[model samples]
Target: MNETLKNNTAAAEVDTRETVLEVKDLVVQYVLKEATVEAVNDISFSLKEGEAIGLVGETGAGKTTTALAILNLVPDPPGVIQQGSISVCGNDMLNLDVKELQKIRGKDIAMIFQDPMTSLNPVLVVGEQIAESVRLHEDVTASQAFDRAIEMLELVGIPGARAHDYPHQFSGGMKQRVVIAIALACNPKILIADEPTTALDVTIQAQVLSMMNDLKEKFNTALVMITHDLGVVAKMCDKVAVMYAGRIIESGTLEDVYNTTLHPYTEGLFNSLPRINNKGSELKPIPGMMPDPTRLPKGCAFAERCKYATERCFEERPASRYVNETHTVACLRYDEPDFHIEGVED
Candidate 1:
């Protein structure tokens, strides 16, 4: 087993709070006639009640696939969860039947998809869409569900009366608000928001993020926020996981991952970002593209692009190791007794 599974499990063991979500050694892939795509590989993490974690990575890093797998929503023909287990509130998610899974989807765990435009139905009024989810999970009449839907709309900062409007009638931000209402209508224990603010303007993005953070606190919901934006992770997440080529290369508290980056891929992400304090400095973007999922390297996927990579890094897959109580990094450099990233203190 990789150290990721062992180290993450050990981290979970130390936490005293109730674990609302746990994913153990998850491996997801897409099998096509052309070639098999390795998406998520042996990733493990757990979330306590009301805590939030950020799945930060570039596109095609399998953030969305991981989220879909948790809800058992991965399309069957092309996609498959070849191994691993997903647990939500002590219920085994992968083994649950469709009917049982349906019960948990909206109530126990809800997802806010990437795009708000395609997520909603234009034909149906926004109120009914939110009401549908409420009706599905709760033992309530249509009128009660509609009432709850209006309450949800109001909670999301939309006028309760606007619930009668169709999705087309609302602006991009408002439509996103409506989508948030639908996801939160059932008061889910866990919420997986997959780039909820991706489509909005900067002003609206802050508004939406603030609103989601407020609602999460109000509902005491554990959140798995998937995004490519490190700024978003810094603002919303208690813990952060940096994924590269379908694996979590580094994970820890926000301060640990952001301030004390251990993995080369994660350091590259930070280096690529524009810094206000360093206005004249050119951005040091990570060189080369992400590895092809179908033709992933047998060793470290980032070895080819990594400036610090040694011959050993290209020949052997690195195992995750603890840098501190909460911080874990998958880098062979950590295995050496005296090795350290040039400027990072011991």
Candidate 2:
């Protein structure tokens, strides 16, 4: 960690706000007839009320799996939560019955999935879709729910008259806003947005992100933003947790991770981004690919690609340790005295 950056730890200190969501030692795996896949290895994090955190990494880094686990929606046949606890607003999600879990899904916690086109029911009017969610959770009549749905559409910047429009009638950005409106229809305490802007154009993406941020503030909702885009993370998140393979390699406040990145994987991610000031420079993408989930490395999953990895990194797994009070990283080099990763010069 950079010595100068260590002094800027005020934002990374222990949050005293009420914890809205908590995951402890979560282990999720997919059981197959041929081979078992370790999707999410013992990863844990928490979100306080109205706080936002970005879960960032390459695809198949178990970001979606973690979100599904939080909602207790991981499919039973193939996917399973092998161990750990997920608590939302003090309710134990893992132990709840089907009926009990349904009560919390749309009411307490909501999710905006990856693709908006497939998320909505094409046959149903957009208003009804939102109203259906409202009716399920709130003790409101059909007419009242429909009225609430219209308000939700208007809230997302869509016209109330467009409530009768089907999903196909709206553009890509409009559909996403509808999806967001539905998720926030009942005022969920937590919102998990999994690459909400992936399918939209850059202009629409910016608008949607701004809208979501404003809505989050208005509702005081804790948010978990899962994406591969560091740019999105910087704009919307207070804290960041970088994932690799199936575990969190590094995590801290935006300032801590961005200014004083600890893990080599995190460094690689930053290096891969195109710099505005140095437009002519070539991007430095991480070498090698993610390890096979079915047969993950015995030690560090990132050792093969990390420039700083030693023989010890390939043999012994490193435990997550806090460099400062709130900044945590899982690299063996942190155990060495006065060690720091030297930045690569262009």
Candidate 3:
């Protein structure tokens, strides 16, 4: 993180309202040679306590970047926290020093990544991994931590109570369970799950999601689930944030995004799905490729592919204007309520 990026963390007093995690005006840049890629543009949103908000986008749309930025885990060389305020559990994550940040990160907030194998240490037994997390954050003895590890593994639906099992002893699903168990061992108030169900079979996915829901309810943890799967988002989230080219295109309640998709980018996503009842129906993929983040097009990045885009969209980016009390979409068509998305179909 550059000094410029580090200094951008000054934040106003938190919104005493229903927000527990507030990611405000965040921008993340990855400098490669002479180029700087805006992995996450000026994006902002809030995650209330016990609320699950899904972040959905195609690969490279900055879903992971946003998550990493919040965690302050952006690696060097290619990444820098450009600007933003990531306030979680009444603390400013970006502004805090590394020592202070570490204390809050796993202790108050946790993350579960996509690849469990890489996440786990090959040398250490799975039990010690979770035990280390508990010991790191809490004043617990090794025996107590080991016992807690077994309890958490059981909570996450791992079959065996053997905390001494090595990472290689577990199945892919089991590895994920262990990863999640380690994440929750510290009893964090916030949990960030990045592509939690990817690389798992459908049955395992459901079970993991069920376990997560149970855990969230039990712990009252605010969850930030990052994924490209609309199905997962629909199934797991109360609110949804749809991103394109590093910026949020639309955001609202699950019903708002599903029932009344205001952005054309979101519409394209919904169109690309096969209806549940229409099994024989053809899958409609979104036409055209995703925009390159490093050299994004002028105005709205999705304008070229958006069916509702107009000539004006080619010139200026649309502000995230309100559609209702809670729903907001970054599209100019909403300026005229009578304008139908079907009008601009290519």
Candidate 4:
């Protein structure tokens, strides 16, 4: 992790621009017959135009739920937005009507789901799917939308002539590229990519990520990338927000969080990453699994797994403490003068 951080030191500088996505006190919950699961608990973060923020955490840390909440796509009946404010390009997402929200989805914010094989319709031609998204969002004829779809396919490195093919006709990597094209066809202001590279091989993952980076720059799109891959975060994001349970435990510029890790969980995350130089060393996985969302602890959710956890960590939840202008961490250790951990900053 240290070597990876050192090598990617130049990846943290995000361009300053007007805020494109602002989420404040966002809380999402799921109600089942058995229990009420708190999926996202009072989390807030903002993204600037043309910026990308990596939401990194273990599975069930609410990364995908956060993305769904932002796009107002949280499944109802079981899932509900208990409270939150999601603003995209100055438009209030939670308060919008169904008609208005529908209008905003493809044009203002688009999503590329994790599995392209399931995301794309198996029966329909890939070009038609992209064209449908374009025609739905923009006032264009079917012919024009098809042309735009072809252009989008070309942009993602898939030949425009291949647009007539079905999902089964393309390879895994190309299918993912088609997903990217559909997300970009509307030229959305924001793109929520949920583990876009999870299904691809290493080489294909690199290609998809490279295309995403190029397309983001071309469209000036703000992105909320939800993934557990730190290497992906280092390469694609300017800032990072480390999530635990349903909350953002630490957030700042990539350098601040990666180089000077503050939270014990954040430190543990970096420690857990396999170092390229240390070939013989065993990887340190975070102890225990994530707490059950339905039965979360009254104190810190990570207290059970954290080695540095004290009595206070089990007794009370910590408030967000600002260690610097750009960095903030939620931990009781920072409040205690006697608490100290090597390789961690206050």
Clash number by candidate, in order: 0, 0, 0, 0
Worst 10 residues of 4 by lDDT: 7-16
> Model 4 segments beyond 4 Å from truth?
1-16, 344-346
For residues 227-287, write the lDDT of model 4, one tens digit per residue.
Answer: 9998999999999999999999999999988888888898888778777877776777788
Clashing pairs in 2: none
What is the alpha-carbon lDDT for the whole of candidate 4?
0.90
lDDT tens per residue, model 3, 1-346: 4853343333223323346788999999999997889899999998878889999998999999899888888886689887889998889988889999889888989999999879999999898898898888889888998888889888888754668889999999899999999999888888999999898999999998998999999998899999989889988899999999999999999988888777888877877777787687666566799887778888889888876678988889888987775688898877785875641121
Superposed on all Cα atoms, the candidates' RMSDs to the truth, in angstroms, are: 3.0, 4.2, 5.5, 6.0
Each model's TM-score, in the order given?
0.95, 0.95, 0.92, 0.93
**Residue-by-residue lDDT tens digits, candidate 2, 88-109:** 9999999999999999999999
Model 1 lDDT per residue over 13-129, tens place: 666567899999999999999999999989999899899999999999999999999999999989999999999999999999999999999999999998999999989999999
Candidate 3: give the clashing pairs. Answer: none
The positional error of residue 170 in candidate 2, measured at the CA in angstroms, is 0.5
Which candidate number would show the highest lDDT if scored against the true structure? 2
Q: Judging by lDDT, tell me the better candidate of 1 and 4.
A: 1
